[model samples]
Target: MTTMDLHSMTGAYALHALPDDERAAFERHLAGCASCAQEVAEFAATAARLALASSAPARPEMRERVLHRIGTVRQVPPSAAPLERVRRGAARGRGAARWALAACVAAATAFGGTAVWQYERAQDARHDAARAERQAEQVAGVLAAPDARTRSVRVAGGAGTLVVSAGRDRAVFMASGMPEPPSGKVYQLWFDDGGTMRSAGLMDPGRSTQTVLMRGAVDGASGVGITVEPAGGSRRPTTAPIALLGMPA
Candidate 1:
């Protein structure tokens, strides 16, 4: 497959949502392809960020309902060595049953929260299915761009890289990087269309390298930017870009 074709499919692959044929082909290629593997990982992380940005509509009393169910679920104990099991059986006698029950209860409680979180996320996904699919396709296309390639960019604190490619049949993000932000803040990306800056995506404070896959065609973007903003990013840039990467159409 061409670079562009690969870039376009990265998003779907990241989400494990690609059609069987395409997914199989990509995996076959990825096994022997270092560049494509890296590309897919970065794209998956970015897709995760976009998914986080979409606020979920709250479900009333959902937390309680989930916890209740979790408490009733069964749990499996970790396997013990034969000698260890024999020793425990002799020592605990009836107490072993109580320990097992306690372990089950604890496991259920711990997994309960996780299960609820997953359910809520599923609901949110269903709520934004169409929009998410469109955006995923757009982002995937950039990551899969034919002639697109990524290069390392040295930054003051850590590993930084730039992924530049094509999308919407044109040049995509000119330059992209991850820089540390203030407490309770994050770096955000933007696409400049005339005087307006539309949110491209958000950054994680812990990340050092950022992969930016442009959505829509980068046909007319005057520049790309990174700014520090509250978590979840902003509808508009709230600060000057810490890094500015531009491309002229």
Candidate 2:
């Protein structure tokens, strides 16, 4: 390859995407090009991080695909061909090497994709953790309020406690051993502003113990309630509340 072509090959060489001949040429070029060498080092570092989250099991289809590709490779038979065919063994060997190179390229491309997926997953996890931390801080602030008070609550199959803080204009509703909602339904929380019930949020249908910080301002709200509602929940309560704990005066 020309020097110009070789200059652009640092990325491909770093990914092992180059054929043996091209890779050899690139290495020769890299020896004289400090910039290319530095870029290759950086790419190698990125490749290293790609496997950090690879502890998770690979999909079954990935294994199957590799097996299928290997099965299709042309391998020279062991000493069964004519003399001329035997002499051409080197050609067949090169073909097999080319196939191996293709497999390496495929693997490198897959690794890059997995790295991107893992990065996005990590970002999402961090965002969720930060949000949870903020919510926990809010819950703690309410509970620590000077006027904070607790009220007992009871539902059909479980009991709970409501900690309200007029000073903070917030409250936390925590319940234990709550039954899963009916099929095609979910449990929803509401804030009682005078007699009007405002939607707070939905509960985890699969979880029995729930800790929820009532959504929206509890400034004028007097109590909180939980009820069964259709999946996705309603703008307002459509069924009777399973439990209600009044705000302390």
Candidate 3:
């Protein structure tokens, strides 16, 4: 069978609707196929949800009706030669039950898929909110420093400033009168701690006055520098720095 054929059977396998032999074959196939395994897991979860939804207490009249039907129903032995028609009727009944089950599973899968999507969206939103909150706190701390110092440096076509907190562990960079860099390049910030250089953050070249929070600690840094680097910035300064300024002692 083609891979597509095998993949198509995942729903049936998940619902245990596949015959015993086909079920065993699909199980072996599932071990080697990551895509099929994921699909099966999703379908299984949906089936579980369906089972939970079906666990509600039955109505009293419905229970009584079921009991009455069971009491009135007659069992016929399959070995009875004259009962061939009864066997055919039983087969038809089984077919109807299978169709009903397939329909229920399809509905449950749709609901489960929607639930999973909503959950993922909520998680992403929470992550973004938390990140923004942390950044705000950092900015507040630096701005509130009792002895925060600012240094201005001249760039090729503009100027920039470095604001370092009194404690010296955090800093922010603000650029002004600066023109955007050429295409395929970006402005990058760096902290020179003692003699070692560390990447601080990336600045938007298009903005004439852009403020960026430094990514690296500047506690013992002697100075800060801005350099033009390839898009996405670089690990180390690769081009001549556009501006450099020393921190106050």
Candidate 4:
């Protein structure tokens, strides 16, 4: 093969797009040609960056849109006249070579941007997963505590259970058969430490059975209470509690 033909095949070789026979031939040539070997190394690095970018999850419709575009787009071949002109320009002062290098630089820049965006998205996914795991472990610890005590409380339309571990200062609240709250209202949990009540958090009432780790201190709480309040909840209970359970004496 001519020197130019071998040089042009470096990109295809780096991308693994060459046929088996052509790839074998290229490898043999690459062993002796320092310039072609260096070009292949740079192209391989660019391909790795593009691969990283494409590893991210795509939107649901992205596959359909990409396939539609591929089917509709027309491929244009380079005209001999323009090719001849470019050859003449390159013969004079390497203008065509500079243009090819510029095109490679632009492609590399685009791939670099995609790689950075995909990396950030991967990091965010990892953080979300880690946070969820920690929350699950906290709930598990409260449920498995050997010193934990549990009590059930009956409400107007449903029943709930409170499990507390004084050794861990943790508590878990679970509700069953609870109906959805009225519009603009939610169920809120409270921990009664002596006679003072502290907010736990708003509960999800739509669930037939729901379990959540209480956010307030359980170490000194005498009992647990659930009350109905406006959406986003209130600093103090706005209505009489739906259920209350005293801790084991």
Q: Report every candidate's CA lDDT.
A: 0.60, 0.77, 0.75, 0.76
Which regions of candidate 4 fall more than 4 Å away from where they truly are?
Answer: 1-122
Clashes of each: 12, 0, 0, 0
Per-candidate TM vs. native? Answer: 0.39, 0.57, 0.61, 0.52
Candidate 3: residue pairs that collide = none
Which of 2 and 4 is the better model by lDDT?
2
**Which tens-of-lDDT digit does each residue in 14-55 have in candidate 3?**
666678888677766665665666666676656656654456
Pairs clashing within candidate 2:
none
lDDT of 4: 0.76
Name the best candidate (by lDDT). 2
Where is model 2 more than 4 Å wrong at Cα? 1-45, 48-106
How well is each residue in 93-209 modelled by candidate 4, as lDDT tens digits?
677678887887777666665544434433343455556567789989988999888888776678788888888888898888888888888999998878777998888756657
Per-residue lDDT tens digits for candidate 1, residues 1-249, read 675686577556666666888877766656545455555656555554544424676697898898988999887665678768878787787687889978876765554544444334333334455454555576566667775655443333444444555444533333334446778898777777887887777765776654445544555667666678998788888777666655532
Ten contiguous residues minimizing lDDT sum, candidate 4: 117-126
> Which should have the higher TM-score, number 3 or number 4?
3
When sorted by TM-score, best at the front, the candidate numbers are: 3, 2, 4, 1
